[model samples]
Target chain A: MDVFAFFNLNELAFGLSKLPMFPYFDMAHYIISVMSLREQPGALCVSQRSPLACWFSSMLYCFGGAVLSALMLADAPVAPLSNTTNLLLATLMWYLVFYCPLDVVYSLASLLPLRLVLTAMKEVTRTWKVLSGVSQAGSKYSDALFVMVAVGWAKGAGGGLISNFEQLVRGVWKPETNELLKMSYPTKVTLLGAVVFSLQQCRYLPIQTHHLTFIYTLFTVTNKTRMMLLGSSSHPLSSLESFLYK
Target chain B: MDVFAFFNLNELAFGLSKLPMFPYFDMAHYIISVMSLREQPGALCVSQRSPLACWFSSMLYCFGGAVLSALMLADAPVAPLSNTTNLLLATLMWYLVFYCPLDVVYSLASLLPLRLVLTAMKEVTRTWKVLSGVSQAGSKYSDALFVMVAVGWAKGAGGGLISNFEQLVRGVWKPETNELLKMSYPTKVTLLGAVVFSLQQCRYLPIQTHHLTFIYTLFTVTNKTRMMLLGSSSHPLSSLESFLYK
Candidate 1:
């Protein structure tokens, strides 16, 4: 109900107009540059912040609001609509519904429930690390495991859409027909896209931005170089023994 | 190797007094929260000038930040040298290393690449809506469609940790073992928790806070009415066409 309610007002308008407006307004392009600038020395340290970052984030926020408002509007405004635009609009709006909300949740978690999110993140990593280590020894089904993770992630991304639709059809259509639609592949694909988009969005910063570039460069050059120099020698033999014995 | 490296850091810091002091400083927390709060309210508002809404959001942001910072520091100062603390700290620290950084990446996709996120969310919903409609009166596995969607979203939520770990481990560990760890049961549990938490938190405000009394009222009335009406229906079918046609 909430999902449909969010989409009902925002869906069409957000899909067609508000989503594409940013790129046209040059805000997206400018943000690309501004984010790059933010990483430069003294950019944030200066009293005046980088205008590009400010404008870009703000403009995107504004556009997001417009899309959201359109979603909330009770009546669809009469306008000439095109299929291409519909596709584009639908895509953009869908992404927001799936991913944007999670970002907020993540950010909030990082700020408030940091431990919980962090704990969850840790377990996921630990699981991967262990599995990857085992696979290195030529374990069977390693590839399958990898595929499973990837496919699983994709499915998760689309889950929200499916969940919401379940709710929506319960109200709109007969219960019996709703059951049949659930097994359809196309339906699964769309839901997967939404869930993936949202989850994917929750985890990363944009590339080409200054902050990301700086962090990537630092990790690639510094830690990578250090590891290269030390190789496996820096780790104690006692640690190696445990793995061997175990 | 990445896991080993992360573990090593946790191991090295064995005592409470040995923990890093900088991340726990009040000034740093305040500054980050203040800036984030200022940015987020404008970021979250459905309208550009929802000043009051922004103000309210700012408070929530502040509250969230404070709680997060405290949690971050909870195990900090490292608890005094103890096996349990070590395990807890190691687990917590390892988790953080594995997953937290991915948030930056996901944020990028949702914020800067807004169009992509929105589009994906919509497609997912469309697919879900159709499938849910079709699944009505379907077989047992048809109901699994919903489970699949739920699992898919969980993977999406946990994907950041998986991807980041994969990238980090690529240079160090063999790939096969890496895949194994990704699909392990612990990871599944972690994912399940994330989904539950996200759903619960999202619903809390709507169901518990805003409509606290409404839920209870509905619960009471629905239960009583259902019981009263249960035996009134002769065959549990109002129309012969519904049962006979099927």
Candidate 2:
């Protein structure tokens, strides 16, 4: 089937599996109550309010990443089968069903009413600050086991990205064809124009969300009307975005 | 017409459009080099043998990231085609070009040859420590910027993977013929096994380099002889261990 069906199935399974840990939901509820007393953005303020929330957020954040990495490692097919729509849906569902309770608890706790919650949150932030300091230290001077791992990975990602980008360019042009320079002139000009305009402006030129929505809705209605007109199963032309994804 | 063709066309168009001032290529080279050096198990000790090399490497390391980010902001087709392969190529190319130049510069500038280079390298490494300290100062914590960005993206990736994995499992069933529970039995059991295994053993599984290579290679190659072989392409898939600019 399509992506959404796959997501729905998996989400149902994941939800069912977590049914036994229902009590932890209460812990999240309590945490939310505590957070509700604190100030907005007071994740690390300190006293009791700051530490609990800060620790909770930090643990959740890291745990969330670890879980994601683990899942990928666990044999998930990641081909862009349908424009990442299925993948996005599946992840969103998991977040709502599995991670939401913890997040809600944290969010609620952060919104706690304690006068000193901000103070505690500040300290909590400080504790996170210290850990980062350790990583920075490791990154710079070397020797911190954790830093080494983090930096090594970061470096690798950096190197890999650069290398790949260059190869892509080289691969596009046949050595004999000067096709590198010859491929459709209009396409080249459009690409160049876009690049120059972007560089000069240093601004994003994304189509507005509303514009996209309008277009998609318009396209859908047009397609349905066309089907009615033709009384046929065939589509007139493939959608631009859908074609690109495939 | 194919994925590689599309990717290469995008890269060449992007690269050519920003000609004369190919700042990105320069930046990627330096950034990846530095990050790689920083992450090396014993980067500092190695610097003793070649201070100029260390200096050059660090420069390349920082440069790669800045360039990649810069490239992203450009309105080129590069953004869409930036899969793992392109990322690796960009960074690797940067290293190949800049590595020797940087080494020569460092060696020539040093007064006492080896000993002086070592001393200079130590002094440079100390700069990072100073930078970390500055970030960790009483109330103004700056290190969180990188960690938050890194961790935030990881969370997003993880969330995506979890959702997608669920869908993959759900896809295994013939929806018309099978009920949810019937289909879920094996899937649920497998997930449960994973959960228990993860919780007790502290092992979270996600595919690593081996699998990435397997899938990417699978996509590119089309023969039985290819099936029996495992060779490194001039470019390869990006990993958590790879650099952003690469």
Candidate 3:
């Protein structure tokens, strides 16, 4: 009950106190969404203005927004957090130690729209400023009950160092073998080269609907055809801007 | 804007209505959660207390609870599903068709505890019945925004039948090759056999911590292990349980 009470009371205290605390939670949000989209291109990648665009957009915007608020309350740092102001200045040590290994990124995304709907009853009566105020406030605090998961190979921090040490002690490998298992110099160079190549391809892809259609159709019919796109943000518009205007 | 209004106004109506329509939404809530957990077991599964017990209990209680709800909402062919329920239901369907292929399970688990905190503030004054009623209502609705992803090869719903037809029409496959990709007789039987093997292993594993330690530690270490399990929902207790009783 004390554990429950401390969490509940501090939440009330958090709502009453106003400070910009949104970025911490947002940083921890929706890893699975980003990862899956990156990993599963053959299955999930969708072109814009297709029948799937609105769906993807809502998911990216709303469900994406959903994860930003997952830890707003429960993860209020034990002390000094009840009155936190600077969102970005703190060290991320909490994630290193107390992180629950659960994948809780979707919890917030799933609930956010329902919260909006429930709040809509007041929309007829409340001013736009008031609603916007609530949303702005919501953005500052991510949900707290769930854990950010131990970091992964992608982010480079999931206690793999400790595990590797323990495994080494347990006689999984000899010291010389372990050195061989690590990424070699050529592998690192190849990885860097691949990233550069993909980024270069992003610039040449036809972006506009008609331009892309004509170009792609021509390419498909040609005796020798080639196409390339890499490092494009899921949204083609953003990808186009990355190479062009930006 | 029309999209936004249709969703908002209907939610307004849903809140006003007091009908018992809990079964549908719960069905859609946990697919994202379950999928992520299953996919990232190395990162997420906690091996503590009665390891198999927690795993099996969570599977039997939640997954078993889940499939029951899936049929409930998907089969809501009953009439008078409210301007509200229809809005919620149709939007969910839209998500299914246009769903981002990203696994969204982590999003909900992260957010649930935070919502609990916010609710706790009101709980200070509210009657227990009111809190339970709200919780009961919430369980029925599940998380509303995230899509229950369309069933695919992972969940076994993407039939190779239509895919083959589309490929044939596109001249991408010979009909014979397409037929070959579909499951053959022995493959289907072997798949069934694999599932049976897994469930059997699940049953035989030390779901009860006491039985497991007594049986295994006795076999391996032959002496003792001192483990402290503060809380374990599986087997209703831990190794200390056997010492307490039989």
**A6-122 per-residue lDDT for model 1 (tens digits):** 657335423322222323323222222233223334434321322222322222222222222222221111110112343244334323322454455224433423423332332
DockQ scores for all predicted structures: 0.01, 0.02, 0.01
For model 2, the stretches where C-alpha displacement exceeds 4 angstroms are A1-72, A75-246, B1-28, B31-44, B49-103, B107-246
The sequence of per-residue lDDT tens digits that candidate 2 reaches over residues A1-246 is 234255564454334323331233322322322333222232223212223223333222222222222222231111111123322333333233223655663354334343134323222222222223334434455554443333322221221212222122212112343323443321222223223222222224354322322333334335444554566645534354358769
Sorted by DockQ (best first), the order is 2, 3, 1
Which 10 consecutive positions of candidate 3 chain B have the poorest summed lDDT? B145-154
Cα-based TM-score, every candidate: 0.16, 0.21, 0.17
**Candidate 3 CAPRI category:** incorrect
Candidate achieving the largest TM-score = 2
Model 1: residue B102 alpha-carbon error in angstroms: 40
- lDDT, candidate 3, at B98: 24
Model 2 chain A lDDT-worst window of ten: A74-83
For each of the candidates, the C-alpha root-mean-square deviation to the true structure, in angstroms, is 31.2, 26.9, 28.7
How big is the positional error of residue B77 in model 1, measured in Å on the Cα after superposition?
15
